[model samples]
Target chain A: MSEGERFTLAEARDLAVKALVTAGTAEGNALSVATALVAAEADGQKGHGLSRLASYAGQVRTGKVKGAAEPQIERLSASAIRVDAGAGFAFPALDCARDALVSMARSQMIAVAAVYNSHHFGQGGYHVERLAEQGLVGLMLGNSPQAIAPWGGTQGLFGTNPIAMAAPRREAPPLVIDLSLAKVARGKVMAAAKTGQEIPEGWALDAEGRPTRDPEAALAGTMIPMGEAKGAALAMLVEILSATLVGANHGFEASSFFTAEGPPPGVGQLLLAFDPTPLSGGGFADRLEILVNALQSQPGARLPGTRRLTAREVAERDGLLVPAAIVAEIKALLR
Target chain B: MSEGERFTLAEARDLAVKALVTAGTAEGNALSVATALVAAEADGQKGHGLSRLASYAGQVRTGKVKGAAEPQIERLSASAIRVDAGAGFAFPALDCARDALVSMARSQMIAVAAVYNSHHFGQGGYHVERLAEQGLVGLMLGNSPQAIAPWGGTQGLFGTNPIAMAAPRREAPPLVIDLSLAKVARGKVMAAAKTGQEIPEGWALDAEGRPTRDPEAALAGTMIPMGEAKGAALAMLVEILSATLVGANHGFEASSFFTAEGPPPGVGQLLLAFDPTPLSGGGFADRLEILVNALQSQPGARLPGTRRLTAREVAERDGLLVPAAIVAEIKALLR
Candidate 1:
């Protein structure tokens, strides 16, 4: 952050929106995507931040993403909603889903929103945090293009599907826990290979489905799941909830999220919101404080997402630093 | 099946009911508890099956569990139902929840059931399967007495909380996935200790908060969570969902499920049911088939709950074998 060029949060968002709009994205959709990307960047999730703009803009220009597509929201039932992203950026669709779920959950006690034909929903925590901000407990699952294999199988049949959950607090920001099913992101292996380093043995499997430490071999094979087999099972559950239940393309069938050379990924996401007040008999917030106190009081025990919260505070005070090369590339999009 | 005394499934249920009734359980409650235990036995979950009868009967006899308490169900909101277990066995309350959630989910497309003042829920998957049987996707979470410590801490602050999910299929039994957050069950450690064997390194932390393979030391320590920190986080999520949200005792505050001397556990469980038809635009079953076929096609890949299904089939064909000691104990209770 100290070495790279810095931009205020507003400057970052405006820059991204301008670049995306120039590449044919609708203003509202671009703003939604920009906001999510900037939030991710501020939180130190650089992989999901402004680095994604070049590929996203490329997809829009190539018709792999309908930059101006309007997301359509449907109330399928009293406590169910379906948002069709129309092969557009995922943020706007998720925004629509969040808007619908907040009120629906207040009335129904619990509600679900499913979005299909969408692009990547960066920082899964972002969507759930919004729900938590409104005094609701939120859980979200989203399937991406495949990266990890089914446990014991050589083929990558499931996304490093992410699951995010958020619980509202009475006097603090919501507590958000976000994790991907994969042991580590694929980019780490790529970086290791570039530096001629051996990756961790359990990080990935070789082409023949044997454990390997060779980064090159690991890339050719599939990434190992977090917690081994249990993670694979969780990944499959996420796939079933986000993809199968949404009637969208499964992870294995989706196109790449990092490239725009193929068809739209057509991935899916599911968001569930619950009004904790009635469910917990009005004691949810106070009880949560008890658990939080216990967690924080323990020596060496850290609450999840504390690091992200710290990073966000730093970014808010001193602006976010972006690599000059990527900033240059994004600026070129405005031409 | 060949060595131990065998009993037909019906006989198993009847014996369990008689033993619990003799211990002063209400007839209706006894039947509910017996049904779940027998189902667990049939599914090869012995830890939750007949082996639990002695402890359960003891608790009932000692008045730690209210033997004649009836689960009282209240509709908390349009899509929320609360079943106070009345400090009774958990089965009857979960049964009330299942019945309420099935019809509620069918009407609202999604509904939640929260049960507090409950005892051990035997097998978490059993309740979810009941919902699946009624054409609903079911997810259940329950917090138990503490057996695991928070990550990076020495004290046991969370239970080996379990999460179970079941999705209904078209022409097959529901696909059910049930997992406890612990790396391995504490019983494994106890067995190793009895036989003077060493447990695996990551299975537990010694009383001094260091890794240990000696089963004796591990027994006095906390069980490691599955997936390390991620698993601990999930356990916390389950604790929040089941205990905090239900206004029931947290894992650390609850009594041991294995003993009859302490206060009632007063644990809690949460079940969520979703109607998949409308949510998936009536294509839910078909889309699930596609994923199932893909998974089964892989040679080494096994569906999550196939082993349980096979065990149930075998039990249905041939009677289940029960240890003579346990049979004697139950028979003595009845006498």
Candidate 2:
């Protein structure tokens, strides 16, 4: 949907829930995933919002994402937990892990949880924010199917690894940064596909090493590393933490959540929670607030999540902007 | 020294140690710091090598970096420890932390350490390699003086915030990725300045938010975030873990390891080590080696630290390169 279209957040959520239900997702699962997507769209991250529906539906149809699967804790220690996602969509797995992490971190002061054998999880930022909202410092990472080339290689060997973190900032919006290690997220390529536009140079490559602007060609080729080698390096680090360490897929074996091919497409995720009270002597939140204030009040510099929060404030006040074309597409699918 | 000039590795280490000792560092501290710089030069990280001596000397003369201060353990838990760096350069602090962490990780299985009030630690990749060389997976992060902006807005609110990790790969070199969150390391600007070269567009901005190619202007300007916002987010995350979590100076309050102003910089670093033996269930190094070989076998992709290792290898085979100019500079400093 374009920016001009409007929808109440509730309406958008309900519409998405219905769509998920129609696609055979369990009611609770449908509601959960639906809320996640709506939350994304409401905050104007349309790249990950409703646009993910068709791919999610396809995964469900192909049994790549098992909505009814239950994630089971595989290993637990005093301060760490590892989960097997039971070949399910990753959101529920991550949710279970994050919830457990908060409880575990309460006593341990820090908790690290890993989710493996899961399908695609969306918006890592949201998960960190959830922990931050509860007054914990949170960091999240996920490794998808290999989609970015390692430095110097022309083929994809690293996922568009997304890392997110959030720290509470009192009245100010939580200082959250959710980012993919890749130069540009693969979603931008998909966005270009839908818009029939060419991506910028240095963004991607065709099957050969040569750069290509065509989204389709770029996908067939490889996504460029964020800045030559560093993006590749960061992606490798993510793979180790989220996949190799978590005992999930690594390298080319990792399958995309949006694609239904290759062994149910398992992915890996990690969530870390740190109790600020221990570190701050109970003044942790204040220290975080001070840091946030420093950034916000600096001569120049925006808080990481400020724009989203600002957009959210406006959306709450004036209703959300939805693309009419996207709404029409959704309506047609529902009918 | 330019690319083809060579010197034996011993000769390089000897010279560096001599120079550091001449600059007033204690013998042990001088040896360690000199070894690190030689290692960086061997690894082909010219920007981080002997090039840093002038600034290091300046900091020492100003008393920002103590010559002989030793780090002491201030707090210890079964799985964690906090060290006070005693106003010394990071080499001493990190050397102590590494030994302590290795000992702890051997028993605890996982150990985390925070070094507070430390100076600029050298190339992060080397630290991880040290841990990896000891057969452990290592993750290290250090937040320097504020040099990076958050995302939008402007002004420096974060440092070049470097994050690095290393994984043992059996007989293969450990897979390592060490990098700064800023699009370009501040050192690159210094290099450009020395050479009178223009930084590429988009790498930095002038003091007023206008983009600039001049190295001097970019130095005065806030370093641009690495990948638009992702870079900023990573830097902020690093600050929290490496500074706030460790109870050290953060953001603007952080003292410049490269300059003389401000109270002794309370630089902090975080180090976490994981036992791959437990994760791999034995023979993990061989499995890791297999993974490394697979990646290396792929055309074009080089392991992150290979170039440095190669440089060191070549330097050892021949001699370490000492530019006539750099030697002249060092000799001049002795008087």
Candidate 3:
């Protein structure tokens, strides 16, 4: 293992697909998961990238994830669809939803898809951006294992629910926004803990309901909700939409996502698509351009997805610097 | 005029209706607008309450808000409805949307109503809460005249652009959430300026785009977005969803809501409703109860709508402390 080893996007995806297939995932599912992971790495979301392969492989091997399960899609209503992930990867279920949504929204003006019995969907922006790229407005909400408490509550009763929204643009890339309800992601705290660094105040509370800078204590306790009570309420909104409405396991009922848990963390997601043409009666592109140009005109003000797009370009040109040890660890999965 | 004057809910509504009728609003429209305003006061949202009656009256008098015009409803799709407000107050249009949303959502599982040519729709929570009370999840988004700039731009190109969501609860009132994308409302800055108080930093910027604590400067300049760029992007999302998608005037094209001069604001709104019975099995109430109890079990943890609900109760029992001067102003309109 060397310190300076780098892998091209293709090389990383190939290695990941090999590891997943070796761990018993079907070829199609493995390819989907690998594409998502490699894209995350290329976009600078390293925590959601290759670093997750080990846990995923372990889950597949332990049968915590049903490697060969096929997603089942049901038409709930004229404009609503439901996909049960069969206790497997979420990408295939999401793909099914997307395929249905794009066509249904064009005809219906708006359509909704609910996904259940799924694993982590990884960086929601990826899925939503796909719809936006096709000229549809996309919104996604996901519920995970509990990491945040309700406003004024000491116990972690809700997940740091994430929401992603994207709207198509004419000239520029789609306007994409992805954020979790927590003030910061738990991954950052975990990373700090690994490096023996103290977290900043206000990021989290200890198990005793007291604010603490210790990353370990923060992880054990609850992450602070973004914008305080407002953020917590928004998280609750997501929980109800993605879990209760979709008939998926509640955050409290789901297992930890970072491990091959006792059972598949039967989480849920909701994706909504809207056709701007029929809904707006045209001129969407011009209006969008006006707003986007106004935003970029400012010196310091940048759109949410700009950084990721820049990183992706860099990765495409020069490849990604993968720690040789992590590469070797992933490669060992095929052994 | 006295300092300690109070008005019952009935009294406030009667006065508002009288004023609107005196200003040439149709009887039914006046009643609708009165109900919304009085309810805002009862819920302690003074900014959106009876204090708005004067501007509403002025706009009607100037014909900027068509006092006698009726909202026209059109079905765009099976689950989508469009309401043209006829340059009138938004309450009537929203009521039309609500009536349609409830019926359409029951049959279709989900429904959306887009409203155009509308004036101010005060306190979006009031609208969504109505749907939640009927066992339906409700979401509302509205666009206003420009008050905040795009993320990095100095010129205000978007409104505070509020969003509201509410989900039904089994044993308690609905869990309601409403927020504006601005760090602080323009009304707050206006009030601060009147009181000669300096606002907290980060709430707004000066005319030249420099941070300023002086409320007057903040009002003359632009509001800071909540959560920085994330908030601005959300505002844009609302602008596109409510205005562009509805075939209404964009935020930059709309007139000030507070003024009677200039053309009708022609702002827009979008309301979405989902029926829990069809979307989720019959267990929605039970699941909602579980989450609500878990949140309430902890000390000091309160849901978003709790405070407003409490205020409504107090107002119902003891009436609202209406400033004698404000009461005089409304009564004068009746003359």
Query: TM-score per candidate, in order?
Result: 0.97, 0.88, 0.96
Candidate 1, clashing residue pairs?
A: none
Fnat, model by model in order, equals 0.61, 0.32, 0.52
Instruction: Please rank every candidate by lDDT, starting with the best.
Output: 1, 3, 2
Scoring each candidate complex against the real one, what DockQ results? 0.70, 0.38, 0.59
Query: Candidate 3 residues A209-244, lDDT tens each?
Result: 789999999988999877666667767888988888
Error of 1 at B18 (Å): 0.5
> Per-residue lDDT of A43-86 in model 1, one digit per residue for the tens?
99988999999999999999899999999998877688888999
Question: DockQ of candidate 2?
Answer: 0.38
Tens digits of per-residue lDDT, candidate 2, A1-335, equal: 24556778888888877776776667777777877887888777887788787777667767777867777874556666677788877777777888888876666666777677876777888889999888788988888877887777777777888888887776866777788877777778978988999999988888877889999998888887665677778888887777776667765776666675556877678778877666544556666667877876866566677678887888778776777667765675576
Residues B1-335, candidate 1: write the lDDT tens digits.
33568899999999999999999999999999999999999999998999999899999999999999999998976678888999999998999899999988888888898889888998889999989999998989899998788788776778889888899998999999888888898889988999999998899998766899999888778899888887888788788889988878898889988899989999999999888888777789998998889888878989999999999999998988888877887788888
Best by DockQ: 1
The worst-scoring run of ten residues by lDDT in candidate 2 chain A lies at A276-285
